[model samples]
Target: MPTTPRPVKTVLASVTAAVLLAAAAATPAHAQSPPLRDLADQQGLRMGAAVASHLLDDADYRRTAATEFNSVTHENDLKWESVQPQPGQYSWSGADRLVEFAEQNGQQIHGHTLVWHSQLPSWVENGSFTPAELTQVMEDHIDTTMGRYRGQIQTWDVVNEPIGDDAQFRNSVFHRVLGEDFIAQSLHMARAADPEATLFINDYNIDGINAKSDAYYELAQDLLAQGAPLDGIGLQGHLISGQLPQDIQQNIQRFADLGLEVMITELDIRMTMPVTQQKLEQQARDYTQVMDACLAVSGCSGVTVWGVTDAHSWVPDHFTGEGAALPIDDDYEAKPAYWSIHEALGGDGQNGPDDPGPGEPGTGTCEVAYDFTSQWGQGAVVEVTVHNGSGSAVQDWSLTWERPSGEQISSAWNSLIQQSGTTVTAGPVEWNRSIAPGGQVSFGFQTTHAGAPSVPGGFSLGSESCTIR
Candidate 1:
């Protein structure tokens, strides 16, 4: 059911789009204008896109993705047939290329899938292995592939599209062979392969409270009780024109309360082709609402659009007569949805009255937020988000924070970390160095502790100190 109002007729010219693209490219890196990635960073969440391996060679597509997003998921290259075409044989060239590119750009790589019903190689799809035999095959596949990437990838859609809208497990090969336990077994294998990576069960049509998502919630609770090593749930936010999920926040919060981080892993709103002004406006509002929902929930870690640009989007091919599903258009220009996301992220360089904490005396425009993803008897994963409220983009950022007396910074992700004595410095990698006005950057670290873990205070970005909240 549609929840928002339909848009009035609006139109845009090609010339205007060209101008927007020029302005976007010409803006100096240090200017106050920030990209969507910067905006998401300020909220302690990630903004990402799904990229095909071949698209990395497209300069225009590559530039837009590198600048606007902090994470990348292989749209298809990491899938079954693409990676392993023959039994006991593998192909790593395509997947590896994207991995190297993401590493060079300081973008986090999200392994799209380890198990999926579609695109399976003929060998695996046709092999008439017994239930016990098939379980071994699946386990071997997970172990071999996950072991190759190890800790380089941050998250894995360990099992994808598992549940149908009818609230029952889909008739996928793994499900047929191993029955209900395939989901749990796959997750455990992924965790064993990469102990640090976050394992997620990803599915589409789970954007809001419904039969499909409910089934996932129930299954997740069961898995957790069985100690199945599930850490997150991915809601593929593929929406149609004028149709927004009304209970998005509540749904995400419910899963979060289950001790799992939720992600909008593949977000894009599709509409009729030859886009109209009204449709674009509607799209903008839709994108804003989605980003706002994630921001409102402490457990929502990130949002990933299905594609970076309409020129390369899968919507057209996948949905007849429906296209224009990305923030960037085919002409390499920013669309209405781009500004909508910007507005939602507070990219206007103004610190709202609701800022979580106060800024330093001279740094009136900065804010900081802190939270723990998980904590246990001897260790904890802490998330830190730095918001830049200045009028110009920050090209180079350096933050200083003291490590708690007994806490040791064991590892960090999404940013570079350095330590000297008790003082720890964190900075953006090459890809995340620029912070737009009112934008932010988020990073997390695992700490080793002898006693109960405590949050670290006294944070600063560059010479200007931040108000730790």
Candidate 2:
């Protein structure tokens, strides 16, 4: 959430400047140059932005959202904390304003979230309730919230961030009490409330092929197999500049292959502070890559940037030394990234390679590359790389190898690791969790050894024996 609040005067000034700029851009010569919404509509894409309800009071802010986007998501107004701060007491003033604005503008509403571990009122988090009681409470909230909007909101993020960065179900209250069944139950309740609405499981860090995404892939399949009303998967594409995932298109295609709609929800690319021309250019490229990936996939419905402008971006407050995330700057000027997306949407959508479609399940074939980067009298550093040739993405990958009898790992990075006796198990962290087909991720560890350390054997990726290199 954005912590710093802007004064009404400053916000008005920025909005005024934006309106003037928009007027200038709409001259007769530039009339053919459509706003993002017009371009997106041509390609059957919905260009959207997460909007602040209060900002809509300003004519320019409202105009910007109405003209540039065909979809609107309330940045915080629709969250659990915002709508239902007190148990059984609902507040809809903020959300209602946004909904009305969207309606007047002919825009689709994407319901932010019905259930999330964050922004939850203290009562819900601290209340001592049994599994059955908690389940009822959650279902009631879903019913009330969704039933209110019903067909107005086109899509709903029924479950948010159920999977943690460790590539496992988060130990949220719902999970701790009701277990994984909570997800299925929530989806079922949402479905019953509004049969016409599309329900999605939304999470961050699953934008590309990785362990976290693999978990979602498997979960989507399981839910469908059991006849759960799971309509889509929302990949919160909150990214960092210069680090766009290489296989993002493949990841989206894989999810689409499961016969589910995929959306790049909450998209933003933040960079380190003191923005430069070079950094902005890279940001444009990153935005282009994400939009291109979505365009290339038929099932990828749209791309929604997290916020309307850098003035209210959550990046600076949450991430130290990071800001300038959105396509619009603090002064309400469109940045290069905004134009990049506009151009991509208006031009041919063939920016990506011909889709090879989804890959088949691999034979669990893998390779492990181990090397001693440095060695000392009693301590040594080793770097290990795990390659995935499984043809399909591997979920929750675990690497195991035997270390010398007395050699023990003291410190490790880039992985969750533990040693039991002579065997060491390493699993992917949030960033390096998923290894794309024919791709690899590397992690290093420092260890203390007894005498001269000898190369350890019995290396394996999951149950498949890896050919050591």
Candidate 3:
């Protein structure tokens, strides 16, 4: 059942987007400047893609992935064959390559899962596991795998797709033998292993609002109150065309209300076979709606698309009849959907209000965003986005920002940058310094904001100040 109006209806909605943003800027002239933006306006959402084992070995594929995403999720990184292929002889070949590849490129990594009934080994399935045997096996698996990547990986989808659409816990081996306590123990064991990596209970139906998700919410709340070591919730938003839920933003926010960071992980909007312009437009709108929901929620940390390019997307393989779930098409070219994402991210192209041309300095030609639910009130997070643009390798760089009075700088993350009063500084920070003719680099700043008002400045590798409103 489709909830939103058809494409013809949203075209008008697009018109209002540019106008509203224009009015917000201080200058009446700029405000009335017919709506302008580019791929720069979005906040700190880690746009990403899924990678297959076959593609991981290609130099070209790896390079493209580095450019397109900040984070990468391996589809079968922890499947039974890769994790515990033999009864007791676990192999880390595939997962190792993924972790190594991600690290070398300075990208974030997410361990796909520790437990999923679908991909487990047959031994773990019907192979004689008494209650004690299962519990030990579970603990050993969690401690071994999670502990291996303790400080490096960002998060883990601890337990995936455990609940049915009907809201009852799915009756799997873990449940039949270990029962509901299985969920709690799994998370607890995971926390005990890494303690640093964020642990999430992930699933698909919990993405949009509905009876199915309502059940997810209630269950999650109970888990939290009982002191389950849960730090995040993952909404695997596998949305399809003509079927986006309208109250998605509110739904994401509701989960954040439970005092945990929420992420749009494993997000890939699917569609029926034989795609079309009208269908593509609808897909863009769906992406916009999801990104907008993430932008509005405070505790919402970021959003990660399931795959970066359609050539490597899993939609075609997994779904009965769906393709074009990614923003980039098979050839790694940008699609209408890509522009739509940029638009939702405050881009200036057709997908946005006013798109910028190539190599525009300080215009955020290359950048990263942090869409934290709350602002840096009296505290601000300063982020530096560095780009090689085209034909440059940045071995070294520098940044200096002029701040307003009465604003004290607080703590910072990714300490590659340095700060100075009214004028904060970063860089001369080390890098391979070669952007490979057109490569890019970026880092973030978390500072306290003040009423005095300020817009960030001091960029290098080619730009100066960003267009601050």
Candidate 4:
């Protein structure tokens, strides 16, 4: 019988879907993009990181999903029990809501796991079942869960952590009865159910196909030779600063050589408890190296960190004395990790993943919309309106720009700003002016752009609200 996994919170929601448009803004005058941009933008290494609990409630998660990432995976959203609790009884509400949320946000979804010994429901592990019965239960679970997410999830961890660091399979019930065949069987079941979905055998300890990775690697190769359904190998990269096993990239490439798409799933760099400057810097270096590996390989899909913010990380809960493993801080503030990823993806984080996206730069209670209308070479007049919905004043805010060409900012209106590489800064757009609850005010800027960021969706006004036209 599978056991019920501990859930952090309710994953169900009634999400309203709406279409949105982008506001046209004149490109800032005399601005240029960074000359030394990271290779990610050109290669399209889709940006993503796991989210914290705060994101689940605020509209930020949707915005984060839309702008920064092309694909989103449940940090703990798609655990085994969340899908199947009792035999043949499946719950689609939580996972369904997540899928809807991802779709509305203009992102793709990845199924976390179809089989994991850790989070299995109680019945599946202890329930009365013979060898044949267990296999049937396994088959049923895969068919139902994968069938529901069939095409929506581009990749599914058909089996997660099937073996320990030792060469043998872990002591899950499946191992006791179905024996080592459980892995091959589970893969077959998931593949049969969702042939279109990419099936991956995911596990940690394989960052650089070491002994543990090799065991799984050999297993995967043998299965492929026998014509089993295995699409990719997911490298669970939970590395510390400066210590990504030397062969990690080579391991990933080696797996790719076996004719499978390689993904750096669950990639995060942790540090000693109170994060130090050295660790943070090393974290940045490690992150860049992983991106280098992905860029070096041809079939690398992309990297997905376990979570974006530190608030809801699985590290503190699971790994002792280790914290701050993700890119952004709990408040969704940009850390070195965030900047590293952006630069890696050709984004000089002047104006980051839409102000409305989760893990974005703004505090999304007050509505702020800006309009830029001017010639490309002229100082543009951008009008910004700050509408206060909640009883608060946006003490500080700023609008920044990055040009497409390799030019730099020679001048700016605001002095309290700093320019980074090709990114030009203009403000700590301090609204010493306050907007009373339900009141509104407007502000403007003079700038230039090679082009404007597409507000691909619409202006997310607040929770359950959008300014759709």
Q: Write the per-residue lDDT of candidate 4 for residues 1-469, one digit (tens) a residue.
A: 1123323333343222111111101111001111111133346664455543324553334333333455678765577676677666766766777776555443557788888888777887666778999899889888887887777888888888888889678998888888888888998898789878889988886887568988988988888998888899888888877778877678878888999998888887888888887788788878888877887788788888876456557777767899798876665455677667666765553332112211122344555554442223323333344454566543343434443353333222212334576553333322222344555444333333355422213343323232322
Lowest-lDDT window of 10 residues in candidate 3? 27-36
Q: Least accurate stretch of 10 residues (summed lDDT) in model 2?
A: 349-358
Superposition error at 90 for model 3 (Å): 1.7
Two-way TM-score contest, 1 vs 3, winner: 1
Stretches of candidate 1 exceeding 4 Å from the true structure: 1-32, 349-469
Cα lDDT of candidate 3 equals 0.62
* TM-score, cand. 3 vs. native: 0.68
* Candidate 3 vs candidate 4, lDDT winner: 3
In candidate 1, how many Å is residue 417 off? 29
Q: RMSD in angstroms, all models? A: 11.4, 25.9, 13.7, 12.6
> What is the TM-score of each predicted model, taking all chains together?
0.70, 0.70, 0.68, 0.69
* lDDT rank order: 2, 1, 3, 4
Pairs that collide in candidate 2 are 210-434, 211-433, 211-434
Sort by TM-score, best first. Answer: 1, 2, 4, 3
lDDT of 2 by residue, 339-444 (tens): 7887788633221212111122233368776766556567665667676777787777899988788887754544567777788888865545567776666665
> What lDDT score belongs to each candidate, Candidate 1 first?
0.76, 0.77, 0.62, 0.61
Give the poorly placed runs of model 2, Cα more than 4 Å off: 1-32, 347-469
- Is candidate 2 or 4 superior in TM-score? 2
